[model samples]
Structure formats: structure tokens, C-alpha cells
Target chain A: MRISVQLKDFDIGKELKLFNNGDTNIGAVVSFHGIVRNNSEKSLMHMDIEQYPGMTQKAISNYVEMAVERWSLYDALVIHRHGKLLLGDRIMMVATAARHRRDAFQSAEFLMDYLKSRAPFWKKEVTKDGYQWVKSVLDDESALERWR
Target chain B: MIKVLYFAWVRERIGVPYEIVETQSGTVMELVEELKQKEPRYEIAFSDLSAIKVAINQELCEFDTKLNGAIEIAFFPPMTGG
Candidate 1:
């Protein structure tokens, strides 16, 4: 149950190793990485992400706790980056481990879905044409609503 | 006293990030009405509650919840981040 909102990059291998260390009971581990896209229909060049310091952590923690309880996961990790990010930069990561693949896979999806819709981060797109704030997707919200 | 925060488009429209306000324990909707009466700026800021989302203690919350010992209140648009 590790959750972090950091400004630095994370090593997936290192994180997975830490989760798997001396744990023969752990059978499956699933991880997902979200990366910044190179383009948007709005001609976006880059994105600036902003988050509330104390609130952001609380939000993620709450979501992670729900994922753990609902899926019966062994362990989970959530790491999100902030500040100016360019195309191809890793924005966030979700890793889940459990004795069986079902729990690990479900937990990983749960974390990503919640992070996508529930987190308190804002993304402002910078484009060659101009800049604009990204709009919330109804589809994403609907995806997270299933777990709630 | 509770700290009220505005973010993103709400911050841009309201012209400030946060402010400290003194109010009796009230539901979030009641507080919004109280804030709307404080000044014209607040009136404009909270004119359209439909577009705003409320968070009490950082979790997404409803307006009918009481703010008895809540330390912070956040108002922002529907989240659009990943």
C-alpha cells in the first residue's frame, strides 16, 4: 500500500522488485503507465499539471484504500508526477500485486480508473495555436462510476 | 473559520486561489449563499453552481454536508486529469 505524488520519475523495475521481494506468495503483478501524448485535436504542444498539496494525497489515498478493500489486493502502488510535462513524459503509474491474477488485474484497473476521474489534478494544454484547459470526459467518469 | 479554495477555471474567474472566511457551521450550499452575499466578486464567482464541484477535506463532497470542523473547502470544475 504505497502511494506517492512526486515531482521525480519512478523506476518501474525498482518498484516492482520492492513489492515482490521475499514474497513467494505473490504470484501476479500488473502495472500500467500513463504518458503524455504528443498531440491533441486542439494542436496541443505540452501540458501543465497542477495539484493541491495535501488534498491530492488524500484523494489518492482514499481511492487506493477503496481499491484494496474491493479487490482484496496484496499490495498497490500509485505514483503521479506534477509540473510541466512534455509529450512522451510519464504522467503516472499504477502497480498491483496479489496471489492470483484476478485480484491484481482488477486492482490495477480500479486504481487507474479512479485516478483518471477522481484525482484533483488539472491539465492545461499548450498548443501552437494557443492554450486551453482539457475538458472532463464523460466516458472516463462512467468508467470509474462502476467501482463506486 | 475554514479556508476556501478555488482552482483552474474557477480560480481564473474568481481572480484568487483561496481565502479565509468565518461562517457558522452550515451546509456547503448555505455557505455558497453566504459567500455570494459578501461582495459582487463572490456573487459572480458563485453565480453558476452547476459548473462547480465541492470538496470537503479533499474528498469529493456534496453541498448538503455540514462543515462543523472542516478545515478546508475546495471549489473547482469537474476534474479533467489523468
Candidate 2:
């Protein structure tokens, strides 16, 4: 499994190719990408992301391990970026590989849910209206209930 | 000395990203109380305990969680990640 929390942008095409590793046992791959959005009609100037340096990686890796064990995943890759991001910029991505599509799909969803609810990253959005810290939506936290 | 870190609005109001705190507080709340007593900025930043979250050594935990040799502590708001 690969987990990266960095300031630099990643190449999805390259990441996928590297993720496959020519492993014939893996039959399915499911991936999800998260990008910066401006739902308020171009008002958003940018977003600044902050994270705990030591804890972020460790927390994500623990969840990835759980995903692999539960889904019997062949491989998994998670990349979450930190620092300044503008509208439409890819903020994060998660890919899961398993022998079956259901396992891959479900694991990817699980990872995404975990990231939304439990990850340490914090975002501050600067918009034409004003600069404010983004609050965690209640719905997102509730989304984790399904996994339990 | 424990390393205390803050993020987002907590850091903005506290005026520092991290600090070395010397404390004998047994629980997170005790430590918070001590910091709150140290400066008004800390008091303001931590005014609403319900809005803030705490972590001991990077693992999210309750305010009543014991310190017990923990080397690092962090305070922030609910995560808005991913």
C-alpha cells in the first residue's frame, strides 16, 4: 500500500500504472478523486490545508491496513495533498485493488469515509465573501455509521 | 516538557503553532485549564470546549483522557479533510 501526504501534485496516470504492478491476481481496481470546489459561483479564492506532520500518515496507514485486511485487498494507494489548492484542483485520491469489484469498491468507500470523518487535515477557504475555516458537515460524520 | 500543537483557528487565536508546555496536569482538561490561565489568547481560543477537539500523541481522544507520560498533545477543531 502507498500513502502520501504532500504539498506537490500527483500524476494519477502514473500512480495507477505503478499501483497495478502487473499483478494478475488483482482483478478489480476502484478509485475515487477529491478536488477543490467552489459551489458559491466562483467566489472561492483558494483553500489552505493544514495537517499534523507525524500523526496524519500514521492514522491513514492504520486505516489502510484495516481496509486491506477486511477486504482482502491486493493493494491500495492513498494520496492526500496539503497546502494551497484552488478550485478544481485535485485534493486527494484513493485506489483499492482486490480480486473482486465489490471488495475494491467497498474498501475505497470505507477509506474515503474515514478520511472525511477522522483525518487530521483542516481546511480554510478564502472567498470573496470572507475567509473562514471550513466546518465539518454533520452528514459527513454520519456517513461513517454505515461501516459500523 | 510536552509538545502542544494547535491548528486552524486554534493556532490563529493562540498566536503560535506549537509550544513546549511544562505541566503536571493528569488529564487533557487540566492541561487546557492551565493554558487557559496562562494567557487570554488561550482562553479565547479554547473558550468553547465543545467546538474544540483534543488528541494525545496524535490519536484523537476525550478531554478527560489521561496524560500519563504522553509526549505530544494537540488541540484543533473538527476535521474538514478529504
Candidate 3:
């Protein structure tokens, strides 16, 4: 299990290779990547991501632990980036490895669901008009409860 | 003294990133009430409890959680990251 909270973007291929390390016992691997999106109504210039330094990594570890405990995973990994980001930039990624695809896929989704609302990150979108904090969506909250 | 930290808009509105608070408040809500009495900015910043989330010693907890012997507490808006 690994949790990384960083400011720089990660290499997907390199991270996955390191996560699994070509373990022959692991037959299935699943990964999810999150990208910054543009505001449809406004021209988004950039986004500033604020996070609780010590707690951000702590929160992510808890979520990853939960996924690892509930699933038959060989490995679990999460990489989240903070600070300034532009549209289409990769913001985060999670990968899960298991003997079969089911556990890998479910746990990967479960990790993502938890992080969407539980992780200690706040995003402020800057546009031509102004800047505004991205509000937590009700759907995102409900998404977390799905695995429960 | 308890370390009180704020993040995001909470930090922006409160006008300070963090402060060492000396208080007799027993619970998180009581601590909030005490801060609210300090000035109008604290009250304005914490007007909506639903919009805020609290972490006691870096662990998420209810607003009614006890503050006894706690070293740190953080308050921020609901997280929007994934």
C-alpha cells in the first residue's frame, strides 16, 4: 500500500510499474486517473488547490486502508497532486491490484469514491470573471456512501 | 493552549491561518462559540456549520467531540478533491 500527496504530476506508467513491480502473483490491475476540468460557462484560467499538509496524507492513508481491508487486493496506491493546476492536467490517480479483476476494479472505484469527498483538498477556480471555491457536490457525498 | 487552524475560505475569512487558543471550552462547538465571541469575523466565518468540517488532532470528528487534552484542531469547508 502506498499514498503520495505531492505537488508534481506523476508518470502513470512508471507509478503502475512501481506499484506492482511485475509481481507474477498479481493477475489483475485496475487504475483510475482524475484530470482537471474546464468550467463550461466561464473561461477558466487556472485553479489553486489548497490542502491540509499533514492531514491530507493522513486522510488518504485512511481511505486506502479501508479499501485494502475490504477487498482482496495485493496492492493499493494513491497519488494526489496539490497546488496550481491548469485545465486537462492530471490531478490524481489510484491503482489496485488483485488476483482477479473484480477486486481490483471495485477497490479502485472505492478509493476514488472516498477521496472525492473525504480527502482534505479544496480547489479554487480562477476565471476571467473572478475566482471561486469549488463547492462539494451532493452527488459526490452520495457517491461515497455507495460502497457502504 | 490548543492549536486552531483554518483552511481555504475559512482561513481567508477568519483572516489568520492559525492561532494558539487558550480556552476552557470542553467541546468543539463550545470552542467555536468562544471564538465567535472574540470578534465578528469568527462568527461570520463559522455562520454555517453544515458548510464546515472539523478535524480534531488531524482526525475527522463531530462538532460535539471533546477538546480535553487535544493538541490541534482544524476547520475547513467540505473537501472537493478526488
Best by TM-score: 3
Q: In terms of TM-score, which candidate is stronger, 1 or 3?
A: 3
Candidates, DockQ? 0.76, 0.90, 0.94
| Shift of residue A74 alpha carbon in model 3, Å | 0.7
Least lDDT summed over 10 consecutive residues: which range in candidate 3 chain B?
B60-69
TM-score of chain A of each: 0.92, 0.96, 0.95
Which regions in candidate 2 have their CA more than 4 angstroms from the true location?
Answer: none
Error of 3 at A29 (Å): 0.6
In model 3, what is the error at residue A137, expressed in angstroms? Answer: 0.7
Top candidate by DockQ: 3
TM-score of each: 0.92, 0.97, 0.97
Ranking the candidates on DockQ from highest down gives 3, 2, 1
* TM-score of candidate 2 to 2 decimals: 0.97
Please give, as one word, the docking class of candidate 3: high
Q: Give me the displacement of residue B69 in model 3, in angstroms.
A: 1.0
Comparing only chain B with the true structure, the TM-scores of all models are: 0.92, 0.98, 0.98
Q: lDDT for every model?
A: 0.84, 0.93, 0.92
Error of 3 at A45 (Å): 0.5
Give candidate 3 misplaced runs (Cα > 4 Å).
none
